[model samples]
Target: MKTHERMPELLAPAGSREKLVTAIHYGADAVYLGGANWSLRAKAGNFDRAGLRDAVTYAHQHGVKVYVTVNIFAHNRDLNGLESYLLFLRDAGADALIVADPGILLLCKETVPDMPLHLSTQANVTNKASVRFWQAQGVSRINLARELGLEELRTIRQAAPGIGLEVFVHGALCISYSGRCLLSSYMTGRNANQGDCAHPCRYSYSLLEEKRPGQYFPVEEDERGTYIFNSRDLCLLFRLPELAAAGIDSVKIEGRMKSVGYVGAAVRLYRAALDYVKERREAGAAWEEIVLPPAFADEIAKVGTRGQTENFFSSAPSSLAMLYDRMREIQPCTPVGIVRGSNPLLLETRNVLEAGDQLEYLGRRLEPETCTVRAMSAADGVPLQRANPGSLILLTVDPPLADGAEVNALFRKQHDRQAE
Candidate 1:
């Protein structure tokens, strides 16, 4: 394999065990995840102690790295619980600990001083001076604030060449700075810093008037409630070459709270893009991004998303309405059938599932897998039986299905489906 500059590490999200596998299988050089505690994503199906051990084992086995998030800003109350947690993470064999608190960093240095640390984006390490300080304090990496631009990132990359620079290459972008927001706690008593963000920014709004005798005006339209603060999904998949060229160590894809299919597709898409870049470099082709076709990316959106966008990159500004519109369906098709069989379980495609259709299974804690349809049933096998919504059918794969793993027998449609 030819090296095109040192290959950028494709860091992806791992919300659960299945997601961890998907991220690795689809193509992630490294993964960042929240533990059951001390992590930013409260809603994700985080790993318990044993689970973390297993996850780390699995990633390391696959020649991938796993980073645990201990990045939550803490208070005096949170400190007492700190030492035990740090010990647990270090014992679990995590690749590194991502932390934001100075006290936490100090404690980590004193306790597990050999444990590698990365400054969280929450640290808002916006300057070379802060980077130097964190490096001196023993932070091995830094996830810079979201507000930084290409120029700022390039400068940091140059200044902190030894320290790994990770960026939010994809996922939701908060309108505020560096995820430090009191909105959820301020409005609903649920602390966002503690992982219970209400996503108040995504909520629609209108002006309420008490003196006007019970009247309301749309905050933006006077009629419709607008998600004025809702921003687009950051899509740097097409800009792989630019980011890689900039000398960033890791291209971090956000979404520890996202679905397995979402995890699988995002990692796979970026992996393909990265490989494409490498291939271009090998062939001496111009290093331009070969993004997955729009329709191809649209398939990813079906997993569930606010629409995707290239946020804050171009500087010229673009309409972000597409991102805010919730009219687009999430999980576009209902999971209507189950795959049943053994001896290398064959997913009896009750419906004509096309190549890229992601198979979702309702497993323990909502864990799902996206197995691309490599081969379907032959004439001797079950056809699209036209069984109703809740039908059970038999099928087979190269390996038999596990005793009880639910798989949503997915089928593609025409145009997209027909081409498949």
Candidate 2:
């Protein structure tokens, strides 16, 4: 690696033990996961106590660090067992605790003094002063808010060069400042800050003025009203050099609730991008020559997403950052199968897989490989023309694969399948 090409750690989301393993196996340097409690992603398949221990052990065995989230804004009742939870995480050998609440931070300091603390993005850290203050309170790292621009980030880095700073280089972007929003709670009675976001921001709404009780008008003058608060998904794979130049210590990829395939593909894509930048820097090439590979964008698109946008990274974000017309992810395919065996490759189907259907196999630390399904048979050796969901079938593959490879269908953009 070149002297100036120190690659910031690529931190991926590990929502469960499976995700944790997938992230590490796919080349994530570190992973951040939420516990069953005190996490912002309540809908995610979060790890419990036993699962947390197993996850930590798995990541450590793979030479990856684990950061557990204790970042929820707590009410009086929520703080009851927080101290014990903190100690449990410490004993579980968690590398760090991602926290947002000052009270939680204080409690962590009082309870587990040796536990490393990472300030979560929910803390809305937007300046060096806040960074220094947190550092004084024993925060070793700060995940900066998404509302900051590159220029603001550069200034913060210049002011506090010694303090470690992380930024969200990819994944979902919150419309509110640092994700402090009342829309979810106000609309659905679920507090977003407490890990139960209803995602009211993604819902379409119309205008209902006073004295217009029976009338509804489109907010954006369209027939379908508008998804006013829907923010576009963030993508910064092409801007790794700028982030490194801005002195970012780590680059985080969000989406703990996403699929295992998403986690695997994303980790590989960002890992490749980081390696590409480091290789170019080591070659002593001009920064102008560093261009993001077109394939990188295509690979990212393979996973379901609403759309991509820079989202305040370049300049003041306008209407361009929000996707008004669509709300759900536009996935191009259905996850048909997952590899259960390497030798004489076996597949466990999530969706129906038919003979002669072209499939894409996604694996850890490797690019996706496309192959045609020539023949299929049940695990019992019965010849089959099609394998339904929950059926395990053996595939005749030209190149044998290692265990745990994921197989997905290559459906077109207009083709949409119900969630399996």
Candidate 3:
């Protein structure tokens, strides 16, 4: 099938149960998460056995698919409970298991013979041979390494037309070659492959001359210290046409460790973009002639990032791919609270929200209504000028909204002024 003829899945990351729900509400066709033990994102509130079951149930109920992460590179001791975990995932009704290690693949085949398998990017399936190799091993999908260019992806797709091809369309760019770096383990004794990465690559590095004791030199000519290895976050919203044409089956977002607000905003933006692309494609529009919505240009900025780059997608990456300073977030808005109830609009505050503040309700349908924080007070009905983070607050809504909506405070990053 032609790439535009088939709509690719929008796979979002969900680190926790709440995030999973948020992703689904924001229009994620599928969500990828890790179980507590086998996930690479050890710090990301990964689902326990019960949590995994609940998450799967919730996602499936919403008609969204869930893929469990079992991609950790296992050692001898790690394989002890591997079978049991696979069984748990099978019982949990996960749509697939993201696997990297060859041992894990065999174990999944033996233990949960019916479960689908997706080869993680850690496998670095760059060429058609690797794709075919994984396909022989029963991997239903192969997440192409982040380093692959459009031409490379097209080649792989042409070579292995039957297998599902997934690629990271957005999120943080790894400094390593498909996340095979040893810098984290070598620096902090936290193995990246084992799910305990300390992210030492984002740290600034200084040259230490062996001959000149105690003398440290900056790696880059930046007075504010250079983060030589810290890469800019990937943003390929404009390149969706290229990716869809490259025969990618799924467009994956790369932040399982990100916040709930970020998940919702990012997923919604991508969802809208994909819908637009599909519409244009159906209208017989050429890839170069398709125009994205103007609002989407700045919409992604609401999700905090360390800057943005196209990475290796456009061409060979140079210094343009690296961020020589600290990871800067270009956030123009902040999450105010989450709606617990609609009547009187009870909210669990994530940031200070004042009366008359403009609040955007993030929900499954992407409601266009921007609510004003009229007559705000504590949940107990105590009048308040503003509700701080962690407070259970209430806001008067003109037209009452549905229950379980997420609220975000609107502001501009430059002026720090309230968004009118």
Off by more than 4 A, model 2: 209-214, 221-225, 363-367, 398-420
Clashing pairs in 3: none
Q: Arrange candidates by lDDT, highest first: which order? A: 2, 3, 1
lDDT of 2 by residue, 24-92 (tens): 866899999988899999999999899999999988998999999999999999999999999999999
lDDT minimum window of 10 residues, candidate 2? 407-416
What ranges in model 1 sit over 4 Å off?
A: 1-4, 222-224, 286-304, 316-420
Cand. 1 Cα-lDDT: 0.69
lDDT (C-alpha) at residue 210 in model 3: 98
How much is the lDDT of residue 129 in candidate 1?
82
lDDT of each: 0.69, 0.82, 0.82
The list of candidate 3 runs beyond 4 A from truth reads: 1-4, 210-216, 220-223, 363-372, 397-420
Q: Give the TM-score of candidate 2.
A: 0.92
Model 1 weakest 10-residue run by lDDT: 408-417
Residues 13-120, model 1: lDDT tens digits: 998987788687666899988877777887889998889999999999999999998877777887777888888888888889999888889999988888999888
* TM-score, model 3 to reference: 0.91
Instruction: Indicate whether candidate 1 or candidate 2 has the larger lDDT.
Output: 2
Candidate 3: count the clashes: 0
For model 3, give the 10-residue run with minimal summed lDDT.
Answer: 407-416
